[model samples]
Each structure stands twice: as C-alpha cells, then as structure tokens.
Target: METKILPRILIGAPGSGSGKTTVVCGILQALINKGLNIVSFKCGPDYIDPMFHKEALGLESRNLDLFFNDKETINYLLAKNSKEADLAVIEGVMGYYDGLAGKSYEASSYDLARSTKTPSVLIIDCKGKSVSILAEIKGFMELESDSNIKAVILNRISPMIFEEIKKLIEETLPIEVLGFMPMIKECSLESRHLGLVTAQEVGNLETILDTLAKQVSESIDLDKLIRIAKTASKIEFIKPTIACGERVRIGVAKDKAFCFYYQDNLDLLSEFGAEICYFSPLEDKKLPENLQGLYFGGGYPELYLKELEKNDSMKQNIKDALSAGTPCMAECGGFMYLHEVVKDKLGHAYKMVGTIEGESFYADKLVRFGYIDMEAEKTNLLCEEGMHLKGHEFHYWDSTNSGDCFHAQKPLRKMNWKCVIGNENLYAGYPHVHFYSNIKSAERFVDICRKRKTKI
Candidate 1:
C-alpha cells in the first residue's frame, strides 16, 4: 500500500434543499477566480451535480460513492484523481447522515468523510430560524461520534444579523461559522422531474455562476476553508491495476440528450485500451465508422423526442448496428431511445431505434428510485451467470418490456424485480452500472470490443 497526504474537504448539508450545490458551485467558482487547480467530486451516484462542477465551472469532477467502492478503492480513487491538484472539493449527497435505506449511515456523506478522513463544512438553510440553527448543527454533531463537521455555512440568511448569528454559533458550539450566503433569486437553477435541468439547459448559467462567485468572494471565508481542507489526513491504499489490452474503437453517444455518463467509467475503459469515439445522436446522421462497441449512458432522451424522431437516418443506423450484433450497453435514457416508440409527457408519440421490443412512456413518478444490487441471471456481454454488480436507478419512464436478464433487489428491502436485457452483445436496462463496482465486468466489455475489432 502507498500513502500520501491529500488536501480535501467535503461540502455537506443537514439535508437536501440547503443550497449545497449552489454553495459548492459558488465556492468552486470563487476559488477558480483565484487561479487554483481544483478537482471536485460528488458523493453517491448523482450524474447532474458533477455536470455543473465540470461543464459550468470548468473543473475536473468525479463521483465518490461509498456504495460503489470500498474504503481502499475510494481512497485510491481520491488519491489518483487528486494528483497535482490544488484542492479536492467533494459535494455531499442528501443529508449528512442519510444513507442506505434510511436505516444507517453506511454510505452517506458522513461515511465518505470519515472513510477519507476529510473534514466537512455543513451548509444549513437559515431562511426562517436563527437561534434554532445552532440546535441543528449541535444535533448533527451529536448524532455521530465521528461526524467530522468542522465548520458551518449559513445559506439564505440576512447580512444584517450575520455577526450576531456567527458569534452565537461559535461561542455556543465547537464548530466555526465560516460565513453566510444571502438569498440570490436570479442565480437559482431551474428543475424538472429529474432534479435540476442539466447544466446545458440553463440559459443564464454563466451569469448565474458569476453572480454566485461574487457572493462567495464577498461573504465566504475561503482561507479558513482551505486551512480546514489542508488538515485532511494522509490516505493509504493499494494502487488499482487495470489490465492493458489490444486497442479497439468504441462509439459513445454524447449530446444534450444522451449526456449522463460517469467519467471514471470512460477512464477505466481508456485504461483498458478502448479508444472512445464520441458521436451525437441528436444531430448526427449515423454512428462513427469502424466502431467495435457502442455505449449510451442516461440522459433526457424524452425531451428530444421530435428531434430524434425526425432524424430517421440516425435511428435506422443505430438500429441496424445493434441488430448486426454490435456489442452495446444502454441505460435509462439510452434504453428508452432503443425502443420502437417513445411517448412524451403530453402523450405525443415518436419513432425511435427499434432494437428493444417495446415502447417507453412517462410514468408520472420515479420508478424504482435508489440503490440496487443486481445479479446476472445469464451470461451477457459484461458478466457471466450469477455475477453481481452495484448500480442505481432513478427514472420516471418505464418500458413495456424491461427484460429479465438480471434480477434486481433493493438494498435493505426484500423487493426483487427483473431488469436489464442482457445477451452476448448487449446490456440494456434502467439501472446505471458503475464499472468500478465490478472491474472484471468492464474488462470483459473491453475484451468483447477487442475481439470484435479483430474480427472486423
């Protein structure tokens, strides 16, 4: 095992809606203005918040999920990704203590903080209450023995009584009051069914980031936050060994419609000798030439129904490629696009790639949302029979035939369901697979692509 001191801090909240994303983005923007090479991470399996960190703020962002990786792997990922960077700012998931099945803090932000030995700053929404805010901080600290809550940032608070609130909190509690963020109405991000409308959809995104950056510069204590971040303990872990193999080309669908992808997944594929060929499904008329494999990650394909349907050549090309036994992996929105028909929220119908035998429609509510444990029921492109993988599912659309190639069970719940249409050359499902959870599965995928390349 190797060891190195890593400068890092986690930005957490008492719960969701406490402006964690906004505050994290603001602080990130503020720090970027000072010319620091910052690497950001989002806790758990969220694919959108990291978009803001990477796309909107121009930082290298990745996901750190306790559920997907063990402590050693998590440490290795942090150390590996944080190389030559000034600081690592991790955005926490949900509440500080909320975790798997809402029963324990097994995979919460606290788990990430404690496991990585990274200090955290809690951002509490102080819109209505002032004195009681201290109580909430105290409660969070008291709830866990190793909460690692080093500082607090008050959100949506008035600047008039900032001094009084800071003094009261510092004098009464053990944590430091960094500063407060006044409510900025114009900088608020819009939302749809699947959390914040992706960073690409926000029209005034640059202006919003600029406004938040100004607020963070004037209000937040960046020096103190840096000091706390520097206090992170050294992490030790065995460096992961990714096998190198024959290079092969893999076409990946990437655009506003098909943009939900884990950066590490692509990185891992690259480490295994797969050359990524990125093509747009929204505007492109055909898939990239000489591709051995196809990967389509989750995004808002439903939003671009008309655009996708109008592009008959693209849809036909994808359908033909999949039909010709090209190894493909599609999840959620990608899976939705493979259907013969896709209906919009207003019940308008449109044509899609007819690889999957079904139609997809908006279900009006989140279906099977949260963490899931998947066991392959048969040999497939990425896994052998009985192979297990950790994944997450958060979607409102349901397909007429979701397939029965894998058995999925909710963690901490006895509920079991069938998902994923897996075979020798495909893995299409609603669940998003984190390749880190099962490295061999990803290696198998690369191997399949390599063999296809040689055959071609």
Candidate 2:
C-alpha cells in the first residue's frame, strides 16, 4: 500500500494556560474562511476542545489519544479523517513534554507528535517577561531527547516585542517563529470543573470565531503555517476490520447534557449494524420507539438540573424502559441522572430517574480522576468477568452506590475501587470508556442488543 502524505501540525503549549486553544481556534477559523478543508484533532481524552473545533470550523474533530490508542490506530485515524481535507490540525493536551505523570511521556502531546510523526508548534505566553521566555523555549526544545517541535507561536505579546523576540529566538534556536497573537479578552471561553464550558453554553460562538478569524488572519501567516504542516513525514496505516452482526436499533442520548462521547465509539456501533437513533434527554419527551438498548454518555447534566427535572415524563420513561429489560449504558453525568437524585454545584437536589440506588452528590473536588484499568468484577453487557478495559475517569461528583460490578484500578496512583453495574443487559457508572480500549466491549453491547431485538 502506498503511504499517505499527511500535512499535519500539532499546536501545543508550555503548560495549560499558554493560549493554545485560542491560537488553534483562530488558525482553524482563518483557514476555513480561505476555503480550505480543515479537519481538526485533539491530542488527549478531551471532549470539549473538539467541540470548540466543530464550532469554529463546522468539521467534526476527532481524538488521537496515545494513552489507550496505539500508533497504528493513530495513523489510521489521521489518514482516514484527512482523506479529502486540505490540512489536519491537532491541538495538544497539556505541556509539550508533560505526559501521563511527571516522569513518563507516555500520553503527552509530544508523544502524539512522535507517534504520528507530526511536527509541533509550541505556544509561549510572553506576558510578563522577555529574555526569560527564550530560556523556557530553549529548555523545552533541549529537554526532550527527540525533537518533534519545529516552530514557536508567541501568545499575549505585542507586535514590536514579538519582532525583537523573534530575531533573538531565530538567531539562538534552530526553530521558526511562526507569529504572535494578541490577547482577545472579549473572546475568552468560560471555564468549569471539566475544562472549558461546552460549545452549547457559548451563545455567540460564530461571532467569537469570526473575531478570532479576523484577528488571526491579520496577525499570523497562514501560508507559512500550511508549509509547516506540510513538513510532516509520510505515514502508512492499515485500516482495522469492523464488526459485522445482526442489525439492532440503539437509542443514543445526545444533546447539550449528554454530548461527551468518542466519535469512534458511535462509528463502531454503526459498523456493528447499529441503527443509531439520537434523542435529546433535554428536549425529547421519551426514548425512541422499540430500542434494543440505550446509551447515555457523559456531560454536564447537573448544570441543567431544573430543565432535566421538569421533564418528568421522559425521566419516568427511561426508568420504565430500564425496568422492562432494555439494555442501558450510562457514564458520569448519565450515571448521575439514573440515580434517585442529582445535586447541582449549588447543592440543590433535583429528582431523577431512580433506576440506580442512592443520591449523586456534586463534590467540589475531582473524584478518582485520571486514567484507569477496569476489570469486570462480573459478567456484563460490555465485558465478561475478568475482562480488562482501559479508560479515563474525570468528574467532580460521586454516588453513594457506585456499584461493585467492576473493579477499577489506576496504575500510577496504585488506587483501586469498585464501580459500574453490569450484566448481560445493563452497564452504568462514572468511568467514561473508550470503546477501542476493549473492542469486545462494544461488540458485546451490540450482541446484547441483537438478542434484545430477537426477543422483540
């Protein structure tokens, strides 16, 4: 097979608040306006960054998580999604060098750059210092044994200062100074417990993107960026085989409240002969008629407590459907919704479907966050007993009855706990799973749904 020539560049930062998202969104909007097909990607297990990409470019952004996904999967996704696009831009997760922990670069943005053989542009926040910034950039470049970093983008720096710094940086380091981006206070996105507030909450998204596009077009050099993206080496990938089976109708809960799902997860379901029927738990009166199973993904359900609670008919309908032997899978916010009550950040309790026992409380701090390996404590719709699944856990809430159906253990922290309620028909909990972690997980779910369809 001929190798695909992928023109890709990763936008990364020194640390978290280095204006990587702003710069990435700006560049995407600017490129799209120039009539270039742009496919975006996020480097980690982030759902919100991709949402922002969709809002900016109207193209569905995918993920390239090095933590759970292998090099082959990464190349396949990069090539598959970039087929017709002019260029693909992947925004980094954390710092360029930071990874799973302080020690290993297992799942860092740099790892994604190396794994995909893509070049990275490090964004530096030159807010309060000048010469000090150069030291930082030099450190980032030299610290990493293998240099995937090719360029530097200065953020929150004046044009005059950028020119001076650019000269100093170019003369000293063997990297290009892409451009400088001014701080746009008006275009700042809101932040919550789980990173930025989703695109759903941003009312003036288009307006913001337009502003960013205009600013980026004038400030940054798009032609240079395209050239940098094109510098990526040729890569080869073998497409993985999709599962084939009996067709089944799966009701997927999609909306502002349940929007945190991996794009691959849904793609795998469809490949397995699932006719996805998307219904809004926020707006829909009831579930889709005659569903073999239901999927409730993670999101900010607690934020819309009043609206979710007001829809009594839909809540009871879901509870009733579960009781009627319909297979159900819920995670985090979705899991919270299945409890007797869910508390808002303000500590106000709202009644929810009581399929699962106990009240889900919104704790101020993160509850068992980071990646983990989940072993099925017993047989479930997704996995068999003793089946191992790798996924991440990110939430600021906890349930009294998290269940003991699965045993979840985090590698670095050496932490372990019981989670999920699963059987041949149902699986629900706080851990947001990536279907690729265990392909059989999605396979089993679809198989269970197929059996449900047979009963009907």
User: What digit string (tens of lDDT, one per residue) describes model 1 on residues 76-175?
Assistant: 8998888888899999999999999999798899999999999999999999998999899999998878999999999999999989999999999989
lDDT of 2 by residue, 170-268 (tens): 998899888888877877552431253666566787798899889889988888989999988897888877768878999999988888898888988
TM match of model 1 to true structure: 0.97
lDDT of each candidate versus the true structure: 0.90, 0.86
Estimate the TM-score of every prediction: 0.97, 0.96
C-alpha positional error of residue 253 in candidate 2 after TM-score superposition, expressed in Å: 0.8
Clashes of 1: 0
Error of 2 at 392 (Å): 1.2
**What TM-score does candidate 2 get on C-alpha atoms?**
0.96
lDDT of 2: 0.86
Cα misplacement distance, residue 294 of candidate 2 (Å): 0.3
